[model samples]
Target chain A: MEQARISARQLLMLAILFEHGSAMVIPLGIDAKQDVWLAILCGMVLGGGLFFIYYRLFTYYPSLPLTAYSQQIVGPFFGKIIALVYILYFLYIAARVLRDFGELLLTFAYPETPLFVLNAVMMLTVMYAAYKGIEVLARTGELFFFSLYFTAFSGIALVVAAGLIDIHRLQPVLEEGWKRVFRIVFTQTLYVPFGETVVFTMLLPYIQKHEKAKMVGWLAILLSGLNLAFIMAINIAVLGADTVARSTFPLLNTIREIRVANFLERLDVLFMIALVVGGFFKISLFFYAGVIGAADLFRMPQHQRLVYPLGISVLLLSIAIASNFSEHIKEGLNIVTLYMHIPLQVGIPLLLLLFAIIRHRSSFLFRKQEKK
Target chain B: MAREGIKEIFDAIERNPQFRTTASVVIARKQTAEQLLSVLTPIDKIPANQMIKTLEMTETVWGENLNVHAGEIIEDFSLAGKEIVMSSFRLDRNLKKGQQQENVQFVRPPARLRASELAMFKNGKLVRWISGEEARGVLWILNKIKQTAITVDWEGKEESVSYKVMRAKTEIAAKMKKGKPVLTIHVETEGDVGEVLVPIDFTNPANITNLETKLRKEIKKEIQKAIQQAQREKSDIFGLGEVVHRSYPEKWKKMKQTWNEQYFPNISVHVTVDTFIRRTGLRSNPYFP
Candidate 1:
């Protein structure tokens, strides 16, 4: 059913943008204090290992998506149940990311506009992208990749030119010790921007170069990881660790400090652009993954038909998820990362891989004995 | 209230067809808002509403006084964990031609730029004004000192031997001693000789070293004075509290309540200054020397 194929480069772009999406704005691993950058690096390393598991699982099937292959690994009934759970997980995460963008826009730009309107508008765009098929989304990622990098680099340049960064704030590094960094890495950072790539498993079968998938995934992780680390470091250096932790959107505040001349002040526009672009790609990818997964499980011909229903559901779910932004963030960091992300992203995938290996070994040994 | 006051000022200015143009304005808290408005008033129309010509130019101009924006104040306030924030602003008077000609042989401009003074805020309220070397000392500690001239005594008198700070870096460390925080501030500054009022010889390297020691002592004195004032005001303006919190988080939990009141006031501080004289200006020594 998945006929469209995306180039390896497109996959790389999509992955980078996905990882940088809402994670960039929200202070991921802020509990690490000034060593938040360090924590991100450590998380990226661990995330690399997690991706290896997903890659191995993908190799066993080769042509089938995670939804299709699970049935082959286990019985069809349980595999169908697993696929349904993953579909729900994908849609729920998509809603959560949508809410992230909506809340950011509400607080940063429009305090008066109802969050429903903001999220609905964002969801509409994501739905359109989802309906367009994965090829279109990948092409869009390739197009936006350069502009995103341009915005990031220019932001770094302007901040440096303004002499706002005082590296002294990042000093006394590892002051409290390694425990907090490691704790935050495992609990928050590793799962968030890194392990969220589990959604890509649904899309990996669409890649044209299956042989290069592992390399592309790892490179994308490294690039986005370093980008996030550097950006967070700059935020702490410019705004100070205390401010970064306290502020809702530290990057917006960091960009606001770019006053080269009197005329060149208030450059939060760069932040807004980067955020919207990143949010668009990220939300679209997750939304697409859910729609496609649902279509596959229900034995539907066109996944495009499910887009509108799922899109509306995601929009409403985003509003209903939490009473307020703080609650949303709290639930996300504490509950979702622990309960949802770990089990679906890591636990179930590893379980499937183990089952696939054991089943293959038993069948091979039985065939050999029969032949003898 | 501050926002309303600013809006009202701009509204009044906008309504006045007499003064149609105003570029930038930096209003310091040296005078009451009424007094400031009063000075701007008593407007005499020069020739049909170009009121720009009439009033005493109480408006602050660039190069005369540094303009501190609201964003910067908020950033610093948050960075220091709401303890204390400092900004520099000063009032400048545009001198009329007669006063400028009377001051010196050479024709001077029709304006005078006053030295920038540091304004300290505690809990978002303006607490005190710090001027002179003490203000510069705060700048040094904050690593905001870009170009400042420092005067050292030459030949047993406070004669002009000013070292212009080219660049500076301040490193603050908070160490736990006997379960209490002891602070150490290390300042490394490099500069050129700006002015030497007395005859000073740069021919011998010993003289340079001697000058360096004097400069170091002078910087140390300024930093101490600033710290003393901050402690007297019960404000940890140097972000020393943050340093302690960063280094020893568990200990800071108990110390947070009385940080400014008890710990900061009685906190033992050690200041170290390292001064390097890179160049002596146009000549090796002063032409007079």
Candidate 2:
């Protein structure tokens, strides 16, 4: 085993993606109308619980990766199978993330480019980071995190100064009852980047200090959640909720409207770059986790060999998965939201924790008997 | 599974041979000029030409009867201008000149002459004649016949007063209509005052009364009060200036559409103060000066 040290701030970058990705989808899914900010608030509250669950899992197995700890907690055979299923689940999610990035790029920038080209380029970048190991990924995240933060806040400030923002746009908040808000919250938390933080379990073992891991994890979640919520609020305030819902990329659309002195139009290009970089970190982390989990379950000599094949597979699968953007969005809302996310994000983790606790209690009893 | 579903849709679209990438054209034309004419030939159909009609034109040109193939395309046609040449039959010598001059000045009609001057012939010699203000009222009638020979025709009572006429150190007076002396006048003088009485014609008395009534109604205090109230409310919905402004845009552009901005300003308004002496207090004799 090699020493893999990731700082609290690097972990915070991963957490930002988790929160922002889901937060980004809220404006995409629900017809926010006049209450987009409210929709975002509801999403954060629901996403907070999901984040806490990941935090709980990180606390329980402080030093063990989820794949190894899962086997120890359950019987090896069943645990390995469970771990393999999780790996496959993660691979599917990683592929979908890659597809989202490719689709956004193709739609916004180069309409003539093939989907595979976009997918392949992104997959290669993620693969390079994944092959470098978690330390490099974490350090790279740490380096880029400040730039990402600056870009996000500066983008918001520029939009505001452009006179494009209307505070009145956020009015008539919570016009739809709590029920509608809850539905939006549930969809966002369940399927999107929020619940996807469960994949962070794979990275928990790499934290430099084990005790501060839980604190850092929770802090990352909180900060990222607030940042995402603010971004959502700004997007809605600037574009208005109705327009946000209609738009494919809410942030891009809002940024494109930023025209300071008539010369600073089309800021979406810069926005797209930020999105791709952030999305790269997000996708690469999941891809690495998927490969490592699969290798552990198969008792392979090295996980690096699985990376290229898995990368190509994801690229191909993403192209084959959705015919168009609308279908992709529909699958995200319907199948991914209802079936895949609930069990993986909420159910499986809780089950594994229960199993871990019972095993611990039984081992204590067995040791006491042996002493007698 | 999802990929297969999407593939099926694309396959179905490709397999449909009749599915066109663009819009199609339709045409309607006669198979032959007359069904009885069995000598007509049918041409092969092209995609561009779904239908075609044929006709015959007989004309005598250059001393020979020529039977020409002629027909309308009945839809759209693309022709090459280089393949055909056309010439006009009119001769250049028949064209008129000076009709298309680039510039020309317009002449105006003559102005009307003033009254009180008369042309006279004494012993068939030209001389000055007397015509005073008594005849001034009928000057327009007299001037119209001055250009042509005419005899005077009178059918009304007329009266006149004695007056002196002065023109270039000449004074002339004559006994006119009421057996009073009339003065010929070109220039004005204090002693040259003349008076004439002509029979009054009162045509359309009903219309005159109607007009008077309408004027009186418009001049009422209640109408003025309503207008004042509307002005205070800043409701120029009546569009008084809008009407004039619309009729004369160039003149009104300097004023600007400032009714909402400045409200109404500099508009001079006058209210007529009519005091009826005969109808004071509804009794003519009770009026006190």
Candidate 1 lDDT, B2-103, residue by residue in tens: 322332234445556775433323333453333333221112212112112211121111111233444444444555433444333222353343133333
Candidate 1, DockQ score (0 to 1): 0.01
lDDT of each residue in A8-122, candidate 1, tens digit only: 9999999999999988988778889899999999999999999998899888888887888888888899999899889999999999999989878866586436678999899
RMSD list, candidates in order = 19.0, 37.3
lDDT of 2 by residue, A101-123 (tens): 87677655764466688889889
Q: Model 2 Cα displacement at B179 (Å)?
A: 99
Provide the lowest-lDDT 10-residue window in model 1 chain A.
Answer: A322-331
Give candidate 1 regions above 4 Å deviation.
A367-372, B1-289
Docking class of 1: incorrect
DockQ, 0 to 1 scale, candidate 2? 0.00
Query: For every candidate, what is the interface RMSD in angstroms?
Result: 26.8, 43.0
